[model samples]
Target: MSIPSLLSRRAALLAGAFAVAGLSRPGLALGAARANPVPLPSADQIRQDYQQMVDFGPRLPGNANHVKFVDWMKREFVAAGLRLGPCESYAYRRWEPKRWSLDIIDGDQRHAVPTVAYFVRSQPTGPQGVTGPLVYAGRLNPDGPASLPDFPKGSILLFDAELPKMHLRQIVHPHFIHVRGETDADVLDSLYHRLWTMPSFQMDDLAARGVAGVAIIINASSAMIAGNFSPHASPYKPKVPALFIGQDAGDTLRAAAKAGRAAHLTLDAQWVEGDVPQLTAVLPGESEEVMIVDTHTDGQNFIEENGCIALLQLARHFASLPAGQRLRRSIVFAGWPGHMSGDMPEAPGWALAHPDLMKRAAAAFTIEHLGASEWADVPGKGYAATGHNEYMNWPATAGPLNDFVIDGIKRHDLLRHAVEQGPGYTTGRVFHNSGIPHVACIAGPNYLLGIVPNGHMDKLDADLASRQTAMIAEIIKQADRTPMADLKGSDSSLGADPIAGTDSSKRTQCQAS
Candidate 1:
């Protein structure tokens, strides 16, 4: 769940009554049409893919492992009978954090602390590192430096990274009528836009104020660390170093700041440019209409590797189908290069880059964060341990598919272990904005910024993963049979405007989960 220092983007399933589509659709009534039964996703196969991805080590962008993972994905798609376009090659700068350390120095007392490396395109901080007095700055929003009181320019700027509480209420205007906007594309966009801007807005303002360096206290659930920043999207080079420390270290640093103490921080990192791969594949169906399936292929560990496996499993299932039994809508599988290419114009995400192709898509599905172990925020112990799949949705339409998904979970008897309809983010933004119906299956808690590493591969629940994969497959099957017209009105305001002609260029650049 880490972002590149520059471009940072923060970062299901059911079973079903066999041989039946959603109750909403009567055309495909039970026993009326015997469509080939969609093969259920296999837990064993998912486990094998997960293990294989882990064996490649962290798939950091531009690294050999990252390239190898890309190659592996290409091979897998081909083996599954999917066809790919020439791999979209993109070049960008990345950071390599070789070593680093942080400590609070108060007169005669020195306190050592652990650090979560954050990427920034700045000059190297040699072995000696930088030392400066620490200044405490409270929560800073996108409004910029104006939100803060006067502070020492040369001192290190410290802040807490916590998103404010969300109070969602319907927005009504005094003069204009407020239509039912819950499922509006603009609503989702606005919500995500705020999220995607928080880190950058804060960082840019601090940099503008000319702070010597920056440090954040980990303030979320899970003792995990998040370090994702994208240098590719930032137009200005970082003038200061930045890093994150855990809750305990944050408490120590806060104490030091309150006592007017100086701190010594060493950042051992460098910036280098190299090639990273982005992949797109197509499995043509019987009709001219299409459906897009996408997922980011880069991350710290299992946070997103689980997703990659889910995508692979879906590919295998579809490919196994005979031509006559294949989906009625064309399926496009995209393994996008995360943070490496940034997003949009500077580095267009797959959906944005292929506007013409996406225009043909009746719907888009983004698969992400499958099988993360369940965790709870303890009253005093931070995050407590448990186990199960996390299902969050931001569906852009209401139809039989949603009902089928919920019903499938129940039929499989996994409802108690699942959390449905929680707030989630995905590449669904692209299709949603394009006036196409968007659906996403996001599992796991650590999918967000404060992501902690799963317990060395055992925390992921393979059986749960199987259920989520099966659930998504069912949704796709429903969408294939359901007419595109029915899903279009989930948000009617966003008429069928091609994404290329819309304001997608203005959207935030993110390595969506």
Candidate 2:
């Protein structure tokens, strides 16, 4: 996808690294029970580590960058004195780039130009040329934007990114995003869900209205830009080809159709579909319980350079940390296979099979977009990806991704950092949906440029990342050695690893030395 116009297209330079947070005394809550409950990390080092991950760029799953990312991370971990346990790795899905262009000839009036756009499978490519009568299907819904003149079945349809911001109620009306909840009344009242919609659904809705080729306005919704609408479409696939037009370039297509010019389209696409291997590495401790640290190793196929940068970068940081910090609870780092074009609607096959491992895990941390300075507010709190899949049963929801800023704010104790976030309902919805007790955090939008790496390129506010990582490092730093409680009810559907469900004979005291 093209970098947002608001975001720097050129990875420009800013000044200064993140200002380091000073460490005061640890919170005095331990009664010979907990080991200094809260320990401040070496703020300086943590910042440097964060900057390195930011250099990786956006990680869109199911791309070649993901593969390279796995390689880089594994090597880094090994060098860091961290031992790699068995990786629970596999690939389940894939997609390739499809590009298109148009040639318009209106009697004597002729115009041919590129359309303003972004691609789902958006990647740099040589454009193709074709000609046909344009069909203006208008926006996504009949109640949506207006339809263009001469809009007909089997004709090309154009869309605009400037959707009429609807009440969150209209967005979650099952027809839009299919989100229904009891407490999101406040957020629903405020948010405009039109920013994000399934490409396939938008295409199909147009198609159902008797339109053919689809041209969409490709603005990566400022909120949720995690692309790949294949999952929503996997169930009932759409037949028409679709493409995105840049907002600036869309005028050519619109003008041609408006002036009654012959509308032609050219699509040059290579849709690669199959199993692309994903990587998983683990560091096992003697404990039966499990704790997971995971991230998607894949990246955008278009911007292939940044493929696995974050995955490998983070992996290296963890491995380089004190190997002595290995937890007794199995710590498995999972590289999720299908983030973009994935269709494991049910529990991951691996997760479904190993009920025992999942049952044993005390908590999980699935990493995505490693560190962004800002956070979107959660609608509320709940877990997704629960162990019990049947009926309305989800299991563990006590992890970082379920509550994105959680580990950093709560576990890592980045309080002031948490205060900086706005209450935009984002990733935690999936956590609650899947019963995965987790937190989901993406890089803060432009606001955090100085606080996180790539925040101010010259400034490179990496210090914040370092402090955050150190805080997390200290928390996971003692997992294996920490004392774990065995209760009757525990949710363990965090990752696909079997270790999530390991049960111990009795209570074990693991003191992180």
Candidate 3:
């Protein structure tokens, strides 16, 4: 049997009876439901929801597919008996980079340095399609993460992965950043259009400092290229060669910079100004402050798995859900695009706006990966990011799969899985790394699936994921009976979920088969 299959077989033994007698000690609230609990959402339903998403062709940021995907989402939420307020965020145009590239020579060898470029309003003014001598100024601020300080006018940036995270940190800078991982095909195919807003440094701001072009390196995951970027909600236009390049190609530019030689760069990208309309779908609940089931509506331009379609599946499930079963906290089936206008708003911006909502949120479950076979358990329900929300604590295990993560998230239950997986595995590599929207403040700090997966995921079944969601729904139901107030309790309690202790490794008693 295949590894996935054998693993699935093992998981079945551990979780099978859960479906028969109960599932993972259903974390339901005592007598929360008026009657025998309403049946939760189902797998066939989840499967159908996901399959629909796969049908939309690459839901790239600027395409019509993205817009339509959003419309369908809003409709699903509306059908689910949600009050549907002002569509929580949509209708914004982002600039996309058209022509872009870089040039380099190492050891007497010359080749056009490949790059995935960005669109800056004033940076690409050196006349598009123009090839000029590239200037290498050596590394700027060597102590800083991969980056060069000042660039001679009309020079393209060539830096390494060590470059400070583009939008995540603070840096006073100007230089057409040329990342080290893009290639000619990535540009010709117009894949770079989406990333024009990532650096978040303003073009005019950089231009005043003699900035020319920008490039970012995006590594390849095997043969497939990671999608360039999402649309920016910002109104600013970017200028420069917003380009991406492969790792090896970017090194040449960095080498030239290190040697203090003029590195020549080539420009082949053009800026096409226009707006691809965005869409939104809302599933309403009983509260003014809402919890979003957010996911990007756009799909990878060069990949499969319909992102928007998968979101729609969830929306439909919400719609099919009886009003009483849906949690009192609003669940917006949020649909979003994938391009940035160099805006600092961050991914899933709508959800980040409300402090009160983040504090009181029963829980928020963000879903991704519509089809893969690693399906397993969602995390605990207590995983909802608490204070200033960021990666609060590592759950300690990679999770029984993804369901446990989902469950842990919805219920804020972070304890159960600790014994199964070790610390590094839980917080994996660190807190912020495993999760993107992490607990913002660590000092006083707090804080904190599915579908089309066979194997281990299938072994537990989609019901496992739904069970988690349902458990959360139960928890939320329990909270609804209390005063509409702080989740941390009156005195700012440490949260209901306790910090779990480590469980010594369990030795499996194996019998020779």
Candidate 4:
């Protein structure tokens, strides 16, 4: 059945709730009323689009599924009567992991322990694998390898690094500073200030020392592994294999190392030059100033697919409007595939290829996971990814743009929830660094970004998605109405500092290490 038909049936079933929420009454969603010229999207439409993306399975690079989804998107855009730009095409080197397993060979028995995740672009440990004594590298030098003591050259070095505790703290204590009337940027800044103080591991040190491999332990209770989205494009090159292991596994490895035990590491992953489509659909307006609405088209599942659907919804909405009724500023809808590959210039993605457009953009509205389940920690149960009343993280560029989003959230009566972020990379940083106003509203417990495995929208909150999409549409409308100078802000030093306490100046855009 057609999506509109399905949505019409739902609108009838939930007419009362829509009325109470001040949403258009019944048939108004189907056949537009005389009140509003452009009908706001119904919850049913958002849910349907999200499900369609999920049905396509994962859209990660180096897979046939990625190509399939990209083709599907192009067809959808053309159907919406949008124009694809020549700069949409992008290619990059992608890694394909055939067999990735690590086991501790003790005496005659092997214990299979969980690891955070495999490092991106890490060299494989050959079919035979490398077995060596485990060595504790202690805290990584704040300066670098030059400040560290020497360890065995061929040992598997293990060390500890701080995980993003701000989000976790919000989940545990929501009443702390996550109250209403506060911008997400303010809340994030409060939490992320300590992040800059933490020591960062020098991966180059491992390669320089000729260590077989290295493992990092993030100080988190959950066993989720987090790492750079595009490790291969990182400025620092590592000649050895590396992975992030949870605290429990790290403790075990440290104990084993203290007891003079050995570890066998293996990473059967390969990296080669590959190409994936990067797309952009332009809806021209009367003015030259352009507003960008984008999201990554590739991820494990709903974590990013929901964002893509939002982009599609925006495309459909703008395309439906008559050219004369279109807004003043042009709108560019971007669907980037290599966003998972670190979104670097060298990585063959949108940001690297479109510097002129990036610089000229007045404001950007980036959509990631819209309606995601929130995760919580259970004392004896470990981490549990549950709850429908979860909050989203909206990281906006500091200054007037952030002020505008905060005011809009209240004006639109969006649900008051903490804006906690997860451990994943995004395209927001790139735009922010270039002094472009950017806003991102993403849901919590994103499993694709490695919050934890098994976080899905079981009882999908269609209302939340609708409200979020409406807010984004509102932001775009306001951007179009407001002058470019006002939306872009006057402060040149705003995005010069790295986003959320990470030194992104060194690494290419789109890193969450």
Candidate 5:
């Protein structure tokens, strides 16, 4: 069957599912008479959209799955009655690993060590691989001296790095309001923020030291380690092959290194140069100014890049409205790629590329990592849910944008959420930095960067996601009615920094690290 036909069948199935779930109520259709306010997409519809994106698998930039998802996103936008805008394309280097393995050779005995994942953008070894004497480097201290012990040339270095123990309370900004379920005891023990920090810096140092390969002993469970593409920033691409060895195998690997054994490391990968596409579609309103609704298309799992689905749902809601009820400002739905790979341009670059759109933009809204349930690795048990939604952050520019986000949270009963200052870690930070008023909702779940089993479909809360998306929809409506001068308040009137207690700048590095 053709793609459109298949999509039609899927839509029918979804509609049937919604009816069975009692969500296909009256006044939801585009032309239906309304007793209530404009209806947002049902939780079931959001889940179906999210599931379709997850089904596309890991959407690393320039990869086949990423391209397929971008195509689907464009088709969905068109189906929602939005007209397509010119898509911006840029060149980027794509990496794909074929096969990789590590073996410790001690005298006559050779022991294989299980690897969780390869460091993305790490150098690849040939078919013969690289065999060299193992060198054991101690645990890395981020604040410690920036020096390493000398090792023989072409040696495979083994090092340990502890994933920082974090709690939801510790990371919440000072301006957080209506905080819920976050206590000092709530441990966020997964590698959520560690994906880009010390690992990449360590890799860069090792590569500079002429190491043939590196084995990193990540102090986390095998499940957490699995599919973790560390050192994911654009900079700090390691020239030496590297692999993540889980803590379970750390003892054996450490022993081998101590015994002065030889280790063989192989990371067979290929690099392809391709074009990364950033898509934009517009829903015309009564006015020329546009509210840029944005989200990245590239990510590892369901929660990581599911914002595009939410964006789509928002588009559907606004587009379904009657011509008489349209907002004052147009809606520009933007889908960005390369959030995961970092090889392609991000929001800042996109803004520079689309000067005309940026010139007309009145405000911006971004949504990502929606409806994530809190999960952590228990000492005795494995990774499991904590019976609470992941703590979410709404960082909006100080003004009507900030007010709208807080008001929406209260009105929607969006539990376990905090509202902070503008330009937090959301992909839409570029707008806030560019003086375009913005508000964004994002959660830093442990599995957001992990692929496959790590960021599985079960981690999402469809109801919560729908509610969050609904709140965003309302915020957009409120922004539409507010005047541009009121939305963009002066810096002097913008009160104390909402991120006063926290290092908002460091948070950006946490994403780019």
Candidate 6:
């Protein structure tokens, strides 16, 4: 059967199920009664869209690929029958690294060590690079002051950095629920929170100490470390060049540092000021109130920001519907850039730019990091898949909005998911903070922020993403039929605190992750 016929059959089945359940709401009845519901893109179509997006390369803000991706999105939106909205443009200093290397020089013998990745916005080294005596500093505490050996000026510092090892049970947020996956005790070691946080927090102190350069030895494999580019959220530049050396080369580099060998460190990069655009497209509905669908366009790999493709799929579905069959509120498709740029996020900026529209918004949905497969660093072996979809978080505002999301998840069989309280991590936090009802679905796989050799293209599950998008569409339809007052409800709490209710003595010192 054709995709449209299949979708119509599915709609008929759903309508019959609702009737059998005795659901008599006007919106549900109207949705069920429609003879020809617009067809949602098939799983195969969504897969094609995802592949096209991955082919664009890493969509880091203000880069050539990012610009091309935005232009492509604009064209796709127009082709899907969405009216092009404003493109919010902003300027910032963009960093592009050419090449970097680290070498240990012991008298006449020189040893080249494998350098994983450089910290974004770190001070750049010239072509010749900087040479200095290597000094072993051990682990630098992110919490408080620690006694350290004094180093002479113009010496390179090597610090041992450990990535946090987490068990599934340790994710004990009040709203966090472990739907299903690996056992609770399975290690979740690829958490990159510290990779950038430690460096960002210590950059000023390192500069104050007058260090010529810095190297952090992380506990992951060379491939994993090479893919990581953490602390991408910072706008400030550090004074000294910095590099991340993976665990494969850790002992060698550490022994060289302890041996009082001279090392040459280079981070050949430059910052160029440029403008990046944020896009918004509108699909007019029967009423003036709007339901905004948002996602960031900048990321490191395929799964990082694939939400825009999902957004495109949704735009096509809604646009194909007959005008009379459309929802009561207009739908705004927003694609914000600079998510990885460390500048002020474009979501809130767009919200602030159009206050009148914000007033008319009934609710907002932000989607990101969809269809991610869970992967973790294995001891001795390297990064491998865990054969399950990453645990997804659906954080929604308290009240009917939250209930609607849960119901949709159940109806669509979106397993391995959690229904958390409002305003988790995505750009949807803007709507939650501004008193607009909001819900966002996002997943954080180990490779979410990493630019890997395969581009992490293998990490996406097209069928899973299609089901998730369909659930969102169902929820939007339900919301369109329900009264605005019922959807918003009366709850005022936006979200749960990151560190609230935890014991200070037992809590991890660095909570940035």
> lDDT, candidate 2, residue 205?
52
For all predicted structures, in order, the TM-scores are 0.72, 0.57, 0.47, 0.71, 0.82, 0.83
- Ranking, lDDT, top scorer first: 5, 6, 4, 1, 2, 3
lDDT of 5 at 373: 82
lDDT of each: 0.56, 0.38, 0.35, 0.58, 0.71, 0.70
Error of 4 at 498 (Å): 16
Write out the backbone clash pairs for model 5: 196-513
Model 6 gets an lDDT of 0.70
Indicate whether candidate 2 or candidate 5 has the larger lDDT: 5
Candidate 4 has its poorest 10 consecutive residues by lDDT at 504-513
TM-score ranking, best first: 6, 5, 1, 4, 2, 3
User: What RMSD does each model have against the real structure?
Assistant: 11.6, 15.2, 18.2, 10.8, 9.7, 10.5
lDDT of 5 by residue, 1-513 (tens): 212333333234433432332223111222222345346867787778788888888888878888888888887777676656456666777888888889999788877875567878878997778999998887654442255677899999887877665544455455445433344234233323322223453456666668899887877766766776665655556778988887888888888888889999989999898777777777655555778989888888888788888888887777777656767676778887777775555776666655566666789888888988877776677877877788788888887888888788888887777777766656777787776888888887666677775347888888998888888888888999988888888644232322112111110110000
Which residue pairs collide in model 4, if any? Answer: 116-225
Give Cα distance to truth, residue 184, candidate 6, Å. Answer: 8.9
Tens digits of per-residue lDDT for model 6 on 1-513? 212343343334433322232211112112222246447757787778888988888888889888888888888776665656445667756888888889999899878885567878789987778999999887855431265578998889888776654443444246654343433333233322222232353566777888889887877767666656676776767788988888889889888888889999988988888777777777655555778899888877888788898898888778767656677676878887777777654677667655556667788899987777777676665778767777777888878878888787777777677676766555578787677778898776767778766677777787888888888888888878877677677756642221112111111111111
Off by over 4 Å in 2: 1-63, 81-93, 102-115, 118-129, 142-154, 160-199, 202-212, 217-237, 246-253, 301-326, 344-350, 353-356, 373-464, 477-483, 486-513
> In every candidate, how many clashes are there?
15, 82, 96, 1, 1, 0
Worst 10 residues of 5 by lDDT: 504-513
